[model samples]
Target: MDMEILKVDRLSFRYPEEDRATLDELSFTVKEGEFVVLCGPSGGGKTTLLRHLKRELAPVGTMDGSILYRGLPLAELAPETAAAEIGMVFQNPEAQIVMDTVWHELAFSMENLGLPPAVMRSRLAEICGLFGLEPLLYKPVHELSGGQKQLLNLASVLLLQPRVLLLDEPTSQLDPVAAREFIQLLHRLNEELSMTVIISEHRLEEVFPLADQVLLLSRGALQAAGGPREIVGRLGAGQAPAQLAYLPAASRLFLGLAPQAAAPPPGASPLTVREGKAWLRGLPAAGAGPAAAPHSAATAQPGAAARAGEAALLRCRELTFRYAKDGAEVLKKLTLSLYPGELLAIMGGNGAGKSTLLQLMAGLAKPQRGKVELGRDIHTGYLAQNPLLYFSQDTVAAELAQMAEYAGLSGEEAQREIARLLDIFQLQAVIDNHPHDISGGQQQQTALAMVLLLKPDILLLDEPTKGLDPEAKERFASTLQLLREQGVSIVLVTHDVEFAAEYASRCALLFDGAITAEGSPGDFFGSNYFYTTAVNRMVREWLPQVLTVKEAIQQWPDSGSRS
Candidate 1:
C-alpha cells in the first residue's frame, strides 16, 4: 500500500467575525505521488483548507483540527522544513513575485534556501528550460503577460524541488493555452518526480481526467471524495448540482445522455473528450440522421437592433500601441467595431493584445497611431483582471454604495440598487468583510457589482470569469444577457472558450497584434479544431453547430429534460 504523505483529521476553521465556519470537519488523506484535485464552488473553503496544509500561510481562525505531513503535525515542523518541503502558488502570480526580472525571481528562492551557487545555477537552468522561460531570463517581471508571470511563479517554486505542492487555482489568470500547459506540467512533475500535488481549480475539464482523486466541497463541507469516475457516479443523472458545475463537460454530457435508472459502470464514466467520443461511437446508431439544430440564442442575429446599418458604438481604426518607446507594438494597426448590445468575446493566447485592445476601447490607453472613436454620449466601464485594484473601500458593502453614489443614484434608488446587486451576486454574507479578505471569486463578483453600478453603455471586461466557479459564471452570463437586453454593448477579453462559446454573441480571434478572425459562436468554434469547447470537440463530427452541453443535449434524440 502507498504511504500517506499528508492527512487531515476533522479539520474545521472559521475566520474572525464570520458567522459560520469556512471549513467544517473535513477529513482526507493524500498518498505519496498522488495527483489530488481540490474543487468546489466559489468560497467553499478550498483555499482555507490548502492554507492549513502550509504552516506559514495558515490564517488566524478558530480551529478544531489537525493536519499531518508524513505522520507528524504540520504545524510542528521546523520553519525551514515547512518552507522547503511545502511549496505553494497563489491564485494571483503578481502577489508572489518580488524580483525585478525572471532570473532574479528564480534565483531568490534558491538563495533563501542557502543552496550553493553551483547547485542553484544547475537548478535554475533546469527549471528555466522546463518552463521555457530561458528567453525571458533578463525580461522585467512587469513586462511579462499574465500567463508568463504564472509560469515564472511555478518555476520559482519548483526550483526548491518540494516534495509536496499546493496550488490555489494557479491557472485562473492564464489563457486557455497557457492553462493547459500549466496543468500538463503539473502532471509531469507528479509522474516523474513523485511530487505530491494538491490543486484547487474551478476548471475541471483538463484536471479531472488526470486526477487520482477528486474532492468536492460546498458550503464549508465535504460533499464527496473519490476517484474522478466515482465522484461523477455519485452525482446521479442529468445536470449536476449548482455547486458541482465544475464537472467536466464530457462527464456532464454523458450524465445527460445516460438513462435515469442506470448507474455508470465502475470506472466507466467518461471524464475526457476521447473517452466520451469512444462511448458515443459505441452507441448503436448514434446520430443516425442529421441532428436538428435546437432553438438557438444566436437565432436573433447579434446586435440586430444596434447594428442594422447603424453606426458602430465604438471603433478602433488602425491602432498601434507599445508600452515603452522602444518596445514591440502590442496592437498593430488593429481595426474593429463594437455594435451596441454586442457581447464581443476576444480570444487569444497570452500576450496577444486582447487586454490592450480593451484598454483602448475603454479610453484608458491612447494608441500610438490611429484613433478610437466612440458613439455620441457613450459611457464605458472597464473591469481589470485583478478585481482588488478596482476597490478603494474597506468593506464590500461600502464599495458598492460608493460606486452607487458616484453613479448619482440617491435616496431609495441607490439603496434598492445596492440591495439588488448584493442579492444578484450572492454576496450578502460577505457584505461586512473586508473586500481583500474574501475569496477570489467573491472579489471578482464584488468588482463586477461596482462596475454595473456605473450603468455604462459599453462594458470592457478583462478575464472577468477568471476566478469564478461554473455556477457563478452562469449567473454572470445571465447578468450580461440582461444588460444586452437593455442595449449595453460589451467588449469581453477572456481565455474561457467554453463561456465565450455558450454566451458570447460574437467571437473574435486576436493574433500577432490584429484581429485574425471574427464570427458568430457557431462559425468561430466549429472552425477551430483544438481551441473550441469540450462539448464541441466531443460532438463536432456529428453536430458541428453544437458548442455547449445544452446544445449538444438538444441534438440527442433521447436526451430527456435536464433536471
Candidate 2:
C-alpha cells in the first residue's frame, strides 16, 4: 500500500496582482487513511493551500511547483478523474450549493459523476439517515440555517464517495453540539473506510484531539508540523506565534500552572478537558475541595433580570418568532435586554432560536405575539453572519463610500471616514480588492468596517468572529471593548465560548426559546459544567469560577496550597 496519499512539492502560488506569493515554497504530504488538520492565523495561506488540491477549485493565480495525487500530478489528472477521487467542501457552502432543494443538492454531485441511478438513490437514503437530514431533504436551499447548509455540503460531498476529502473550516458556522457530531462523523469516515482527510480549521478546541497530524502556517510559511502534543508543547514553551495562545484551553491551563523557572516537561501538557481534569485530580488535592470558588455573576450585584427592566438600549418584551407560519415557534415569550455600554454574549445550540432572536431584535424578522421596542433615540446596525450579505459594492473601499454616501456623508468626509475604518479594522491591505476576492476573515472585517462607519448607536453582531484568526479575534475584542467604553450597546450571538468568557460583560444561555440563564462573564461561565470554558472546566477544582487562563494564574496561591 502507498504510504503517501497526496504530496505537495515546494508548491507556490501568487494571486493575480499580488506582490508576494500567498503560498511560498510550501511542501507537505498527507498519508493514506490519515486525518490531517492545517492550522494558522487568518490570511496565513491555509485556504490558499486547500484550494490547490483539486484542479477545478484551483484559484486564478500563478503557480509554480506541483501537487500529486496517488503519485500522479494533480494538474495532469483529468477533471473527471479528479472529481471522482478528490472531494472538497469549501468554507462557504452557499457558493458550492446550486440545486434548489436539499435533496437535489445532495444528488446533483453524484449525478454529475455519472453514477448509476440505483447507486445514487441508495447512497442518498443512507446519507440522509446518517445526517438525520430526512425531514429537511425537501426544504428549500435558502431556508436552511448556516449549520444545516454546512452539513448538506458535507453530505453532498460524501455522496460522491471520493477517495480523499478536503474540508476548509467546515464547522466554523456550527454550534457546539452540532460541531462535535460533525467531527465524530468525519472520524468514523476516516477509521471505517480508511479515507484520507485534510482539513484547515481555527476551531481547534474540539477537533485538536482527533487530528493525526497538525500543520501550522504563518504568513505563507510553515511554522510547525507534528502531532498535537508536539505542536501544543511548542506553543506552551512560547516557541510559536501569539495567535495560538487561546487555541486549546486545557493546554493553556496546564502550562500556566508550571513553574516559570522550569521548562514544561515533555508530554506533560493536556489538550482536552478530560486529560486536564485527570491531571488536576492527580495533583495532591488542593486540601480543600476546590478552594471556595469565586462568586459568579449569578451571585454578584443586582440580578440581570432586574437590569433587564431598567433603562435599556434594546429591549424585548415577551418576544415570539418563527420562520414559517406553519413552523414551530422559535422564540416563546423570551425577554432580554441590552444595557448601554455593555456587550452581551448569547449562547445556544444550533437551531435553538439564537439567530431568530437576533433577527427579531434587529428588525429583520417580525414577531408573531410579542413586542421588540428600542429605547428612544437609538440608531441600529446589524452585521449578518455571512459578511457577503452586507456587500453591495464590489471592492471594500467602495463599500465604505457607498455606506457613507447613504448616511449623507460628503465626498471629502467619506474618504476620511473610509481611511479611518480601513486602518481600525485592519482592512487596509484588502481595501482595494473585490470583496469576493478577499479571504473569509478579511471579508468579515470589511463588513464590520462598513457597519461601524454608519456610527449606529446599537450594534447587533451574529457570529462576528466566525472567520477571524486568533490575532484578528483578539483585535476584534479590543474593538468591542472600545465600543463598550463609548456607551454603544452590543448584542453578540456567537459559538465562541472562550471569547464570551473573556470579553462579554454578561453571558446568557438561550435555550428552548428563552433566556434560561444569565450573568457576568465569571459568574455565567463558572457555573456551567458542560457549556463553560476549558480553563473553567479544568481549574474549577482550584479556582472554580475562573474564566480565563490569565485569571487562573492571577488567582492561584503563591505557595503550594498545603492547606
Candidate 3:
C-alpha cells in the first residue's frame, strides 16, 4: 500500500457557542495517490473536518483530536512547509480570491511564501500551462464567471505544487460541463501527477466513479468508509442511513429490481453513464427501441406557459443589460416574463447572463433599453447566490422574526409563522444559531425563509442550490412546488439540470446574451445532448425524451421493474 499522506485520529471539534461537537470522533486516512470523496448531509461537519487539515484555516473552536500530515503534527509544520505540502480549493472561490486579476492571484501565494523570483516564475509558467490559464492571465478576476473563478482557484493551489490537494465542493458554482472537465482534471492529477486528493461534495453521479474511496459523514460524525463500489453498493442495497444515502440512478434502479431477478455480477454496481448503459444492456430485450414519449402530459411552451392569456405578472421587453458602463453586454434584447404561479428554470453556461437576467427581472438592475414591468400589485423578491449577503441579523430566529414583523405579523402569530417556516426548511435545530455560524446550505434555507416571508407575487432565485446535498435539494424542490401551488411566480436561475427538469414547469436556455431556446422541461432537456440530466444521458437510447429517473422509469416500465 502507498504510504499514508494524511491521517485524522479521533478528531472532534466544536465552536464555543455550541454545546455539541461539530465533528465527533472522526477518523480517516488518505494514501499518497488516492482520490477520496467526502460526502454527506449538508450540515454534517464535512467542512469542519476539512478545516482541520490546514492549520492556518482551522476554526476558532474546541478541537480535541489530532490531524497529522506525513506523520507529523500539522500545527508544528512551518507555514511555508504546510503551504508547499498541502493545497486547498475552498467551497466558495470568492472567499479566498484577493488579487484584482488572474495573473496576480496565481502568484499571490508564492509571493507570500517569499519564493525566489526565478522559482516563482518557473512555477507560475508550469501551473498556467497545466490549467490552460495563459489566455486568462490578464483578465480581471471580477469579470470571470463562476467556473473560470473556480479554475483559477484550482490552478492557484497547483502552483504551490502540494502533494495533497483538498477541495470543498469545488464545483458548487460550476455548470455541468465545466464540472465534468474539472473532475476529469483531478483524475489526471491523481493518475499522472500522483497527487492525493480529497473532495467534499454532493453531486455523486460524476464524482462517485472517480473516487477510489468514499467517506460518509452525518451529524458531525463518520458513518462509513470504503471503496466506491463497496460503500455505494451498501447505500443502494439499503444498508445506510436515509440522510447519508445518495445513489446514482442506475444503482437505485439496480437495487429496485424485483427480489427474484438475477443479481448483478459481483462488484458490478454501475455508477456512471457508460457503466449504467452496459448494465442495462445485461437485462433481457433491452435493445434500443422507438424513443419514449413524454411521461407527463404536454405542457404549453415555457415562454407562453408563463403568460397564458393574462397580463404577465412580471415582464421584460427588449431588456439589454451590462455590468460596467463600458463592459460587454450581459444581456441583449432579452425579453422574458413570468405569470402567476408559474415556475421557470433558466440554465446556461457560466457568465451567460443567467444571473444578470434574474437581477433585471427582480428589479435589482435597470436595462439600457426597453423596460421591466411588474403587473399591478405584483411585489417582486430576489435571492442572490450567496445567502450571507441577505443576512443582517445575528441569529436565524431573529432574522426570521424580523422578516415576520416586516410582513405585518406579530407576537404569537409571528412566532407561529417563524416556527412553521423553520420546520418546513428543516432549520429548527439551528434556529438560535448565529446566521454566519450555520452551514452554507442552512444559511441558504434561512435566507429563502426570509424571502418567503415577504409574500411576494414574483420571486427570482439565482443558483439557490449552491451548497445543498441531494436530500436537501429534494426538499427545496418540494418547497418550490408548494410555493407554485400557492400562486407565487418563480424565475429560477441554476446550473442544476436535474432539479430544473424535476420541478420546473417551463425551462429556458440562455446563451450569448439571448434566450436560445424555451419550452417545457421535457422539450428543452430532451433535445439537449450536453446540458441535460444524468438520467437522460444514461438511458438516452431507449428513453431519449425522459429527463428524470421518475419519468424514465414511468416511460420504460419494464426497465426498473422487477421480473
For each candidate in turn, give its C-alpha RMSD to the true structure in angstroms.
Answer: 3.1, 2.7, 2.8
Best by lDDT: 1
Candidate 2 lDDT over residue span 63-144, tens digit each: 9998988888888888788897899998987788999999999989888878899999999999999999998989998888
Candidate 3: misplaced stretches above 4 Å? 239-245, 258-265, 292-308, 559-563
Give candidate 1 regions above 4 Å deviation.
237-240, 260-262, 291-308, 557-563
How many angstroms is residue 415 displaced in model 3 relative to the true structure, after the best TM-score fit?
A: 1.5
Q: Which candidate, 1 or 3, has the higher TM-score? A: 1
Error of 3 at 89 (Å): 1.4
In model 3, where is the ten-residue run with the lowest total lDDT? 293-302
Q: Which pairs, if any, clash in model 1?
A: none
Cα misplacement distance, residue 121 of candidate 1 (Å): 1.1
Query: Which residue segments of model 2 deviate by more than 4 Å?
Result: 239-243, 260-262, 292-303, 559-563
Error of 2 at 535 (Å): 1.6
